[model samples]
Target: MVVGEFTQDVDVVVIGAGPGGYVAAIRAAQLGKKVVVVEKDEVGGVCLNRGCIPSKALISAAHHYEIMTHASNIGIQAEGISIDYGKVQEWKESVVKKLTDGVSSLFKGNKVERVKGEAIFVNEKEIRVVSGYEGSRYRFNHCIIATGSRPIELKPFPYGGRIISSTEALSLKEIPKTMMVIGGGYIGIELGQTYAKLGTKVTVIEGLDSILPGFEAEMSRLVTRNLKKLGVEVYTNAMAKEAKQTDHDITVTFTTRNNEEKQITADYVLVTVGRRPNTDEIGLDAINMKMTDKGLIEIDHQCKTSVPNVYAIGDIVPGPALAHKASYEGKVAAETIAGHPSAIDYKAIPAVVFSDPEIASVGLNETEAKEQGLKVITGKFPYAANGRSLSMNAGDAGFVKLVANQETGLLLGGQVVGPEASNLIAEIGLAIEMGATLEDIALTIHAHPTLGEMVMEAAEGALGQAIHQINRQIK
Candidate 1:
């Protein structure tokens, strides 16, 4: 069957429906621009459907299950503690469905056209979208590429029934008796911890010398300790050689840093090494678009690609592969396309690890700060000393660390590893963005018995006025 070309004019077109693409489309529509969002899959992209939302849902369920099982020890009597994995999965799927539908309704409410198809660049000013099943073509003006990334598949361990990626891991039909996670990044740690709490014998293997390699060593240590307490076996400085499917188990062969080879058997293997940009199959080269050495779409400060009128954002472009980051970039690109001066300031973007206790940070770490030759003052307050953490029965370890300039007291960076660390790091990120100093943060009255007080305590400690802890006056 032959189909005729259909052309449609729009003020702005967004090519991915992930967090970035959808947000951009909605923002452009709010600005009174006729917008169309072309997505090959579901709206809300990976974050709402798979990556962030689903993973967090699983983590929350795991946390609840763990709490209920241990409720007796906390003086709450419970009987026949067990988990129905099937029901848990149903609940998780329901959450994802609700959010995805919400995103679709949002697009409808904002009058942003949602096209379900793969969009290819026919020219700088035109795009041809092939409907997945219908094989229809729709042309649009000024498109935004928000196509996200896919998990990087290791050559030795290809995805299959026994071997899986994060997407498959999230929708596991049944929890494995034993699982081997071949990565120590945030994703691996998060999923690994979730499974461990749910009664899976979980092991994490990392090629790096330490997990969370980008974070401070102290923070990583805290996470490691917490994970160990959760019964997760973490093997750092280890490389996976090969995986063999046995009659009853999957055997993973690895080499340790000390040149020792070992084997571990697990029912499931999750390969969460990292993600690669989804730049293939969209006919990028056909339009002569430039990409970075790392295969990310090359874009300027205004999110303009090498080709004019073709803007790209999200995982396809360079920067942290975070949903929020992509969303911001998407808006910037839309605004710039709308003739507004918008630039992305990458300095204040926050990164979070959703493992048990969680880890969130923004700006520079101590290592980066020291390498820049800036004298820094560091302060820390432990969760054990926090009143709220103790009351929640979640306070055993973890703390908040603030790094600032020694002379100017300007906040350089912040890290939090504890319950709701993901949420608590926001205040620190705001302070860094506002160039808040130690005194500025210390003077601000944080509510008592709250986790946020840790931020104030850390800042006060930096200024040598921490009232709750030992005070060492800065002279």
Candidate 2:
């Protein structure tokens, strides 16, 4: 162990260098506050180095490979198509490295001190930073906890050679011939599809009645169809009983919801059950910070924790474990710290799934709206009728659904399950945030031959004025 002492004070100290923590530091610095970000790992955290960027890079490669293999359908004759997994892995690493370096540069540009150490709360306003090479103690006027979360590893399958976590799955040296994904959530499906596209015999085991348990049944059904198209075998309401590793392969024993047991063999197994908050080793108890039953730090609208002069944001607090959600919360916390009355609008935060035909949604869904006792009306437009989707050969799978207040016509929520759904959902999020009525969206003049036009058409459909589809004759 190495020890060094450096005395310095900052207006704000952010723990963790993930999306939320870095964004908070930058925003605080922009507000003319002296900020320092403490990180024990890479500057970009899991989103850039391990999770989002890496996974997307792999998916992009797989998508290209799949398209190239089927080039004959598009009037292009191609032969001798092959994939070099080594090159793909190298390219992905290069992208991650460039982005990580860019983030470090941003910290320098913002004049925020980047400390490479693990921070433990010594008190409300003090922390001890211990590093592998150097150790120091720091003091601050205000602190933000953006420590993020970690993947929950199941006891039956420990992460090693055969059974692995998403982090390891992303860094595989070669695409396994047979793979088993042990989860049905967004992460499992996303990676499972990517591997299947890359020529892996991928099977997904989800311990729920449906894959995306929290999403609407219709949306989940559509996604399941798409997965089947990619040649992925999905087992819903199936629990993995045990994993046995042999010299040649790994066998996973699972039990179905009906109490029938089965076995499957695979070269690799990915466990993407879920993530848990990283509050265990942060010394939150020492600072007397209040946490919920799930161990998430309790915060108000402004992200203020129970301890005075301390705040929390991102996955450490409540809400979805999305990077953008955390980033927005970080900005709000920073602005509030700078004496700028800033509050977060949780209703407008869009959640996106980067699957084949993607999924995106925001605000209240049908069940939530009904549970709230609001009089709601829903409108849907299938992509099968859209011109651009047909041109892209992606028209058959999904549709866009919009929910509005029956009397006021005010947009309440939006859900999409089609190509570029993630991108199209942003418009609805903005509209909902601005409190736009159905007519406001219907008259917004969406461009022709684009996915965004569907938003307008859906809104118009709700108002009984859609041009492409037959109007619903309302009594």
Candidate 3:
């Protein structure tokens, strides 16, 4: 039963309090706009509560566990190390709870009103929100929608007891002895690798020719090779047909690339194929908002929708549905709504994967630059050549690649597939955003005995100069 009725008039109303929504709300409030954020679930949204933060906590735990159990090579030995999944999950939940609570506190501190409910557009200027036992209406001069996306469920293998999504995988009580991961995207590979490190026999079947199809094959090769070391089997050009749930285990049927039928049995089947934007039933069309054929909201450079006073950001818009991307767009929308003349820019958006050695990329890679018919020069420096990597006993893996214009040496992009790739990509991303050159990076004095030195060395190589590695000419 609806328990309450209320009405609120505000300068701006932000929908879906995910990273994008909350950031937009806070920025709007800071700009002297009376802002209210409407969130159906928790304030932190899926990234903090379900996807990014929780998964990273679990991955960090698994990484530490691997380090503990496999430190014999470094003269550190442990007779046995076992996973306490209940405790691990408890710790993960605690981390998530802390971050979510912080988001709530920020909302209060920013003077942004919080309305707990599922909101739908009642008209171009108003929306109706229903919160469990309460209902309310809100009218706004401007509206911003930051509704995020969710994991897509397959038709044949619907999410349930034996079938699960990443959310369910993150909350598992015990580590499954065996698991089959369909769709070898970054999500599949990361989680599959995580469980494999924890002693789960992971089999990844991908419809593409290679796993992590979105990344460069050479970059993915490093991860796939490490997966082999972890005893995780991967099958490419494979199609998962259906799944059968039984009392003991789940049997998943698939067709191999050679057209041979095969079956893999696992405790559960984890599907990480892709995510669909959460753009349904929120009544966007009610506001005469323009949208793509696939339901993504249409917006201008400032994130303004066709309705002028309305805006959309994050997964509901075109681009990779990354949390940082959403957060960036949120700030743009908020600033634009506050009449700050802010605009969206995607030139330096970085993508990072927390796989075995980690992989990160920003700006244009060689393939993309070549496809665009831009003459480019590329250089690579390996972890083996970096003193820091060898000192850490990780010299056997990873490399840093720099892509730059052949004529101008303007830094085009960078690819890092090694330890701390996520952190290393930030410098190059900033360089690209600021339009720096290979000479700029090469001349900069990177700290000695650091992984970041590889970046500088790669820049030198791109300029046909050699210091740490032999310079190879690019035709």
Candidate 4:
């Protein structure tokens, strides 16, 4: 169709085929709305193809290799453990293909139309989708914008051949012999440690005093210690200034916190400073949607935008730029559009980092509760005392800490840093969401010789009845 020559009308139009967009489209369809989703590139968005899924696949392979090579501690010896980068790449791609195909099948099953194109808002109720040399106008009863975000390109280190972004890092056929990571956040820590396990020398540079700044200091210390064990050098309070790249190598210049300038050479520098919301060039100005200076869309509890009948979710809105968070908001927005009374309840949004000795947390921490002037009690237990953790030969170091109300024993928050932390956090997340108290978790019987038993033990410690550890009596 030529520009404005034909108009496709729909009950609801979702302006991105990412996680949030596709979920919103299917949900709208389930609510008896004819929905159409537009995407400029892949259907599964950054999470499926680049950000979450692919990186995790690589991390899994790296972790398996690391554990298999060190099996001598369990009297299991392997002659050699090596990673075939090509095979690893293929496996990662297979994982992505399976997921993206599932998302496509979901759209088909839900009768939601998928359009491949970049959509620019023509007005409040209309959009012009441009794909190649062709264009079409879409008019809808309501619109849900889930355009997502992109990696922020630092001026000092523009991404290219030698200075690459996380997207490019995940796709390398042969892992670089040496790599420099320019951020200490989850992305930098995960990938940097991954390559280290794959026989690459990795160095991480961070502007803050510590890497993984969002995590608690104690949790970060555990990760930092393990990163150092992998021989990944971390330079905190260091600022990356510039990169001079040749065909085969690059020298990166950075300044230390004490105003000391330094330089290091590496095959590639992976920059993961942060992400920027993709709210520009879509003609958001056409509807004058209220947005923050950094391009985050402002929305109500149901994700309703300033303009009527328009909603925005995912990375384009405030809150953590997490795939699960976006999906949650997508559901809320779809429900609100369908005239349902759905609102966001972020009582227990869990954040997990797949670093060495993985870190995960949900709800309030001791610092957060203290900041909010809430009197709380905390109980902690270590993996060293857990039978399951010791049996698996992962009992060296790690802990689970639970926070609860001082007066009522109501669970306030929980943090885990150890083996299977990602999976273990789910139980506590459900506990917090269901408003279960510390006693509830304490009395619930967890399976014997299972990692989940730590949850109950931690809860018991909170109630001053812990059998696994010496309990400090607290009423």
Model 3 Cα shift for residue 278 (angstroms): 1.0
Question: Compared with the true structure, what per-residue lDDT tens digits does model 1 show for residues 298-415?
Answer: 9999999988878899999987899999989988988887789999898778999987678899998788899999999988898988898888886775999999999999999999
Backbone clashes counted, model 3: 1
Identify the superior model by TM-score, candidate 1 or candidate 2. Answer: 2
Residue range with the least summed lDDT across 10 consecutive positions in model 1? 132-141
Instruction: Write down the TM-score for model 3.
Output: 0.98
Evaluate all candidate structures by whole-model CA lDDT and list the values in order.
0.88, 0.90, 0.92, 0.92
lDDT of 4 by residue, 321-437 (tens): 988888999999999999999999888999999999899999998999889999999989999999999998889769999999999889999999998999999999999999899
Which runs in model 3 stand beyond 4 Å of their true positions? Answer: 1-3
Which tens-of-lDDT digit does each residue in 64-174 have in candidate 2?
998889888879899999998999999999999999999899999999999988999988889888888677877899999999999998888988879889999999898
Better of 2 and 4 by lDDT: 4
Tens-digit lDDT string for candidate 3 (1-475): 8767778899999999999999999999999999999988888899998899999998999999998888998998798688889999999999999999999899889999998889999999999999778899999999999989999989998999989999999999999999999999989999999999999999999998999877898899999999999999999999999999998799999999998999999999999999998889798778777889878998889998889899999998998989999999999999988779799999899999999989999999999999999999988999999999999889978899999989898999999998899999999999999999999999999998899999999988888886877777666
Query: If scored against the real structure, what TM-score would every candidate get?
Result: 0.97, 0.98, 0.98, 0.98
